[model samples]
Target: MTRTSAVSLIRSRTLSDVAEYAYAATAPAGSRLIFLAGACPLDEHGGTVAVGDYAGQAARAVANLRTALADAGASVEDVISTRVLVASARQEDLVAAWQVVRDAFGDHDVPSTLMGVTVLGYADQLVEIEAVAAVLDEPQPEGAACPPSA
Candidate 1:
């Protein structure tokens, strides 16, 4: 069976380093796209895991994002884009959170936006992230029956 992988698109004028976040993404046909809600620092017990610490909160949020993708039969490699939000607009805080995000994404080079905000949904929550992934469907053998969609 054959499957198509996601493609990252870049414009000629853009910096090559921006491959870390392609200006656009193209998913293969018949791919199953998953849109995840923003993930916070909530622990297994549904309580906030890291309070006041941006880096710690970022790590927990990234972990939660992985869990969410796994639940949808996806993985970090399938991610196409991500939006990262930090409670403070400070560069240091954004850097702290971005480091954790980079660690989580590894070499995948998924497109991402890192921004600072005045507040978040949960009180004391320093970081949150939302992601979109494309899980490609394997090509069925010729004449095989098609699988039903969920």
Candidate 2:
């Protein structure tokens, strides 16, 4: 496996799992790449976030994505593309859910695709997010600055 660093917004202050803090910055060259599968509003124990709440579902979806990225040695900043899924008939619900998704992905204006679906793998899951990211082997160029975190 390739050596990977954790990309985060806030550095851990204690010994317990510390999240790194990173701002908006370009990635290094020849970075390792990883694509994350679509993540739904499922908990670590295979539980649903919100049964019918779009916002809650969206939040969980993004959280799940984060976990997946961490497991794969990647971060939201590494993600370059995303596909968003929503299962709702009301446009308002979808818009609300999208906002949640936007907020979760650091709101860095990353590339994303939003789609309306009739249903998801789980009946209670109303939101799903999938993405592709590149993890750099080194820091940004000598003169480059890291991007601000969301």
Candidate 3:
């Protein structure tokens, strides 16, 4: 069996989550690391979840990240870091969006950063997110691709 851990690193209020910083850097040797491409606001059907809706987009992004993590043999608890990009200059909206992610990740840990981007891959997308997870296992299967679309 493999053991994993997470930690928090940021400390800010107002615009910050109550939990501040978090991380999951303690993994035994031979542990594998998974890097997932940024996930946008697209849903399983390849349709935008909530056009111009930052909070909705943020939730969808987290869901996609969770799926990818599971497929890669990791879990939300294994995540060590995350980068979130919101396509807007409104700091208040961004904070609300971040709250959605904070709720999804629960007590799991990871150091996370949020950014305000001018745009994303699609005009309908309001947010995009990427993550890094550490798992106790051999390397992932070579040439493995993302799970086939359902």
Best by TM-score: 1
Model 3: per-residue Cα lDDT over 48-96, one tens digit each: 8988778999998998888888787778888878898988899997887
How are the candidates ranked when ordered by TM-score, highest leading? 1, 3, 2
Clashes of each: 0, 10, 12
Instruction: Superpose all Cα atoms of candidate 2 onto the true structure and report the RMSD in Å to 1 decimal.
Output: 11.8
- Tens digit of lDDT per residue, candidate 2, span 1-150? 655532223323454442122222334556666777888888778888778898988888888888888887677766766778899778888888888877776545565677888988975788888887777655569989865432
**Model 1 lDDT at residue 148:** 57
lDDT scores for all predictions? 0.83, 0.71, 0.76
Enumerate residue pairs that collide in model 2. 8-20, 9-21, 10-21, 23-147, 23-148, 23-149, 24-146, 24-147, 24-148, 25-147
Q: How close is candidate 1 to the true structure, as a TM-score?
A: 0.82
Q: On a 0 to 1 TM-score scale, where does candidate 2 land against the true structure?
A: 0.69
All candidates' TM-scores? 0.82, 0.69, 0.77
**What is candidate 2's CA lDDT for residue 52?**
80
